[model samples]
Target: MASETIVPPTVGDQADCNEVNTCHVDEFLYDVEEVEKLAKKGKLKRQYCLDCNSRNITAYYFSNAGTIIGVEMNKECCEVQEKIINQYSMNQNRIKVIHSDVMDRSDIVASSNIIVANVLDFFVDIEKHKKIWYFFKQHIKKGSYLICNRSITDTLESIGLSEELIDWLSICKPCRQENEIFFDLEDFMDMHLYKVN
Candidate 1:
């Protein structure tokens, strides 16, 4: 399937993502159906989705297939989030938003099937990044996935973290595949998929 053809968002501009303090979900043009197709085809990884049998690792941490914990540093966009949560009320329990730092949420790390940490560069600092990685290493179970918008190396470098001292390789490994996984939906075009090693 062609990756670039996305349904434009009804509200706001995708280019303004960097300028805003908090980006609304509808800011970027994301075709949910296309994204699902990509996930099933093994070309991309989708969060809170269990029907993608093509995935190498089955996220076994969650009891219910639709249960997802959405962790955020701030409550800047509560209204938008509420709208998103309401959209998922039909088939399963909607997303549960945890208003706190990701590192502090040990309960979340322990139970979530796939932790989608999008735009971590905006919220996490250097020291927190190190602490969070260590925390994740200690907590997140094997076989579960971590989907992030920024590269692990880039996140470290952005925080002035020295890779020699802190070895993230021991904790998690990148999802090994023949071709790169690209999510063509909205702000997720450059996202990478990783697994707990």
Candidate 2:
């Protein structure tokens, strides 16, 4: 069988349909499908630990997938999440979802094999960065991973992250508010994070 071209949804595309805050069923499915493909292609290696089992040492996703917990609360996004879950529930039994403020959920953190935050920098405040770091340190087990992506701005200093962290975390600049390929330093700050034990 030929592999399907899975075009993951963009943040702006969802925003346009007024589905940004709602459940993004399509996007969730795309993520699930993409993850599954990666695993099948040997792009994602299986991982195991005392807390959880994950097929991939590093996973990719959006902010909504991380934050929104309940299907009912995130109607649009959950629809997609549920569809994807149901489709691969058997093969992806270990994957689970927890909904809570990233700043507050120790249980979620403790249980997570890999934690992902998309566009998280927008939500972080300089004053609260330390607290957030402390939270991650407390809950994340050694050898686990943290993957995060965020837009770059002057607030980087406020986030208390070193330049090395920024370089290691960021993956690619997808786009800008102006709907153009991100090119400038201001645009270049979009980052991705991977937690290393």
Which candidate gets the maximum lDDT versus the true structure?
1
Model 2, span 49-152: residue lDDT tens: 32454433444343333342331223566567766666544224344444446665677668766666454345556566656666666777766665555433
RMSD of each: 14.4, 16.2
lDDT tens digits, residues 1-197, model 1?
A: 34444453545865433312222233255577766666566555444233643434433333446666677766876555766555433322455667888778898798877877666555666677667777877888877777777776676676666464245433343443667553335555566666766
> What are the runs in model 1 whose C-alpha is more than 4 Å off?
1-64, 87-92, 160-189
Give the local distance difference test score of model 1: 0.60
Tell me how far the alpha carbon of residue 63 in candidate 1 is from the true structure, in angstroms, after superposition.
14
Best by TM-score: 1
Inter-residue clash pairs, candidate 1: none
Residue 30 shift from truth in candidate 1, angstroms? 27
